[model samples]
Target: MLNAIVIGGGLAGSQAAIYLADNNVKVKLYEMRPNKTTGAHTSSDFAEFVCSNSLGAQSVTSASGLLKEEARLLGSKLIEEAYNNRVPSGNSLSIDRWGFSKKITQIIENHPNIEIIREEITQLPKTPTIVATGPLTSDSLCSEIKKLTGEDNFHFFDAVAPIVKKETINFEKAFYASRWDKGNADFINCPLNKDEYENFYNILTTAEKIPLKSFEAKYFEGCMPIEVIASRGFDTLRFGPMKPVGLFDKRTREEHHKNYQFYAVVQLRQDDKQADLYNLVGFQTNLKWGEQKKLINSIPALENAQIVRYGVMHANTFINSPKILNKTLQTKFNPNLFFAGQITGVEGYSESIATGLFAGINMLRHLRGEKLLELEAKCMLGALLEYITFANHKAFQPINSNWGIVEKPQEVEKLKKKSKEEKGALLSNIALEYIKEIRNGYFC
Candidate 1:
């Protein structure tokens, strides 16, 4: 019987361990929590979502959605669990955070072929291993990784948005609507008129922020703090996160103002099955506690909003993947070792699951003395791996799943199409065919 060591119990490690265990391999899954917790996590549960509850858009025409569909085709264990515990967020796949983590912890703890080890691993094991420690990797292990991959691994800070109680939001000013009314009216919107928006922007830009510690460098472009974004200009927030296009205020419409539109809107996405908690959409911040409360209260309907959790920032680290890893996620010089998740430079929850699935499948092939497998670059998953493992080494950075990484087939490229949704649909169809071929030619 083949046995493997899996390090860290975040999304990627848990998914990899489950995949290997289901395939009849024994897995020792190490989670350094409860005894040694990352500052962001509140539980010892595997696959805890420390950031926003969203898994991004869930339509095939969207890049994140396409990546998720590909993961589903590959039988990603976490994606199944996420869907099982989903909370409404229009077309995006958001889950009941606590329920989702509980289910994943239960599954990992109960697996027959898996052993849950509750201890921090200070050094990488010599046995066949998968390192999915994620961005908040501990200092000692990070040092060890640096020794192996050189001292040039990159670091940046990521912030989490605040969560508020649903009851505190005033319904008189807030209404439910999704962008372009494309899906169910699942998102709660707080409308701000031109004057209200201008006042909010002034206070936001002038609000005091928490200074980063000496170790934390620049913020990741994807998760820049709301205040940092506000500092760009007077109209930056209006055009960026607070853009109110493609949405109508139900209250205003009911009040006989058919053509009325707000200057800006703040969105709140449901974060739990009970609908009692909602996270501020695109409101990640590192402001001081007092400043956060003042800024939040300044919003039209959120004057008395009860904050369940405050926004925070933490250092994110990633390996220099192009120089250290192969497309199969194996260390180029040490074939028995592998990496996954944000630690290997793939961002977003769904992207982490994809890398975990690939690492698990490839590890199994390695054990059986078979040729290590890699997906064709025509697919999103393959393209993401190809970029991380083969992109220019000197300019490496963490990346989320996007269609830009995917290499387009000639037919789509020849048509001179600029629509992302159109290109995504064409790529989605081709990727599905590749999935069918992979199933028939390999796993079958």
Candidate 2:
């Protein structure tokens, strides 16, 4: 019997272990937590979530939502576990972070075919292994990964977000509405007049930012701090993420006048179902907490805003996927070696789990002497893997699932009058059909 070692017991590692063991492959899972700590993780719990509790949107039309549905149809343990312990957050699948990880740890621990090992792995094993060490991988093991992949092949950065307590928000000043009233309008919009926006921008530009540690490189372009975006120009933020387009001010009872464009708008999206916590949408920052409080509260709606969580940025590490892995998520150099999760350069929890399930299935195929399965591009899972494994390696950065990543079918495109929701529903149906085809073949 072949044995497989899975490093890092986060979502990716745990999912990989479950799949391999289900196929009767002896599997060992290694996690470096209470014994070894990452800057983000707070506990020894396997698959600990260092950020927000919500997985992603749950609607089948959304990329993250569609990915969850796909995982569920394919019998994904993570998906099933998430749904069972779900905490309602309107349309999103938010969870109690502690409850979520504990459940996963229990399931993995109870599985007879898998063994859990708690220790920091500074070097790769001589035997076949899957490295799912996540973005906050330790310094020592990162060095070994760099040596194997070649110097300069890996990238690093601090990607941080602030957290706020749900009770601190001033509900009187903020309004709940999604842009264009398109979806559930679940997000809270903090509207700003031109004066309020410009004043806030002035404070943002001059605010003292936390300096990067000597060992840490500058942030990756994808997750650059909001301050950095502001420094580019006063108008940069307005055009970038803070743009107030698609939103109409309900209080004024008038379409926000075109000439009255906001200097900028700060958006808060629901972080959990209780409406107690909301994330500063597009407000990732490295600002010192005191400075953040001073500057952020300057906004009209936030003058008395109680910040429950402060934003943070930390070093993130990942491997060069296009060079090292194939579409099935197995290493080209070693059929028995598999890679999954954030280390594969797929961003977000949903994306990470999707890759894990794919890696697990492929690992089973190798053990059973069956042909490996590679999903079609029309499917969300297939499109994600194809992008990671085939995109131009030199320009590659970690990616979250989005419409741009998948090509829409001609039938959906032909309907000019179809709303976005209608189009999404059509595409979701197609994806489910594709998944059913794969599942039927495997079981039959």
Best by lDDT: 1
TM-scores for candidates 1 onward, in order: 0.97, 0.87
Model 1, TM vs. native: 0.97
Off by over 4 Å in 2: 22-25, 85-90, 182-185, 213-222, 248-263, 391-394, 407-426
RMSD of 2: 3.2
User: How do the residues 33-103 of candidate 1 rate in per-residue lDDT, one tens digit apiece?
Assistant: 99997878989889999999999989978888888888888889899989999999988999999999999
Error of 2 at 162 (Å): 1.4
lDDT of 2 by residue, 1-444 (tens): 768899989988888888888778899899978887787777888777666666788999988899888888887888888887776455778676677789888888899889889889998886768888888888898888777767354556655566566566666767777666666667677777778878888888888877777764655555678898898998888877688877655775466465444446787766654657677866888888898998778867777777877877787877888888899888777776778999988988888888888888787777777899998878888889888888576677788777667768789779679887888888888998989988998856
Evaluate all candidate structures by whole-model CA lDDT and list the values in order.
0.89, 0.79
The CA lDDT at 236 in model 1 is 87
